[model samples]
Target: MATAVLVLATVTTGLMAGLYLAFSVAVMPALARVDDTTFVRVMQRINDAIQNPLFGLVFVGALIAGGAAVWWHLDRGDVRWWVLAGAAGYAVTVVSTVAANIPLNNRLDRAGPVDRLADARAVRRDFERPWVRWHTLRTLVCVLAFGCLCVALSVA
Candidate 1:
């Protein structure tokens, strides 16, 4: 069960990190180039697709599994801060995605073209940069967390 947790957490960490790199870091600049209608459509697609409730379930599962693994290892005196780091990483991810992006998405959904596209771009610039920053922190935390897992594995 604990091992399962670790694997799931790793999966969660990897998935979010990949998304951060692909969308916020890579695709967003190009996405900014589209005309208003297409831009809104694409952004809307992204907003709709990104944060499914089921996706949250997957993330929660990963945390639970990984934490359980850490707990199991720590019970035997092979302990570390990585578990906490993983939790914190995911927490940052969830909070930032929910707080910043979701509202922007809602705004875009309700807004019209031209003006809305410009507004979306502004919001994207302000919010996306910070999102990337938090994502970097998340990746770091995941690295630390996985390192702790490796340490646990080694001691066994």
Candidate 2:
């Protein structure tokens, strides 16, 4: 049962890590080449699209299952520490998202649509660099967390 839960945690975290990885590698880079209006508009649409239930499940599930993995491994000495570290790393990922990324997203959202804005470049300038930085941070932590969980699974 503990192994199963740990597997679940690892899988969910891996999914999130992959997503962040994709955004950093492919999505953002591709978006970077477009005009400011297209960049802002596409990002806005993506932000809205990503708020759906499925993404929510994987996002929150990683934390919950990582917690459960820590709980289940508490009696296993060093193994427990691995799970705990993993959970903690994921917690950082979540914190970074809420603290940094979401606020940027909110500011971009509040900037209104691209067509109506006087200067999409200004909005993009404010939103892009900071968002990418936070996202890269989250990606690194999430991948590290996934690595910790994988180590636990392998040795357990």
TM-score per candidate, chains pooled: 0.66, 0.98
Candidate 2 has a TM-score of 0.98
In angstroms, give how far residue 74 of model 1 lies from its true place: 4.5
For each of the candidates, the C-alpha root-mean-square deviation to the true structure, in angstroms, is 3.8, 0.6
Candidate 2 scores a C-alpha RMSD against the true structure in Å of 0.6
On residues 27-140, what C-alpha lDDT tens digit does candidate 1 reach at each position? 777866775456667776776686688777766665666666656555554343555555555666566656765666676666655354556556455545564565566555
Task: Summarize candidate 2's per-residue lDDT along 59-82 as a digit string, tens digits.
Answer: 999999999999999999788988
Going through the candidates in the order shown, the clash numbers are 2, 0
Q: lDDT of each structure?
A: 0.60, 0.95
Error of 2 at 137 (Å): 0.3
What lDDT is obtained when candidate 1 is compared to the true structure? 0.60
Of candidate 1, the 10-residue stretch with the lowest lDDT total is 76-85
Give the winner by lDDT. 2
| Regions more than 4 Å wrong, model 1 | 51-54, 66-79, 112-156
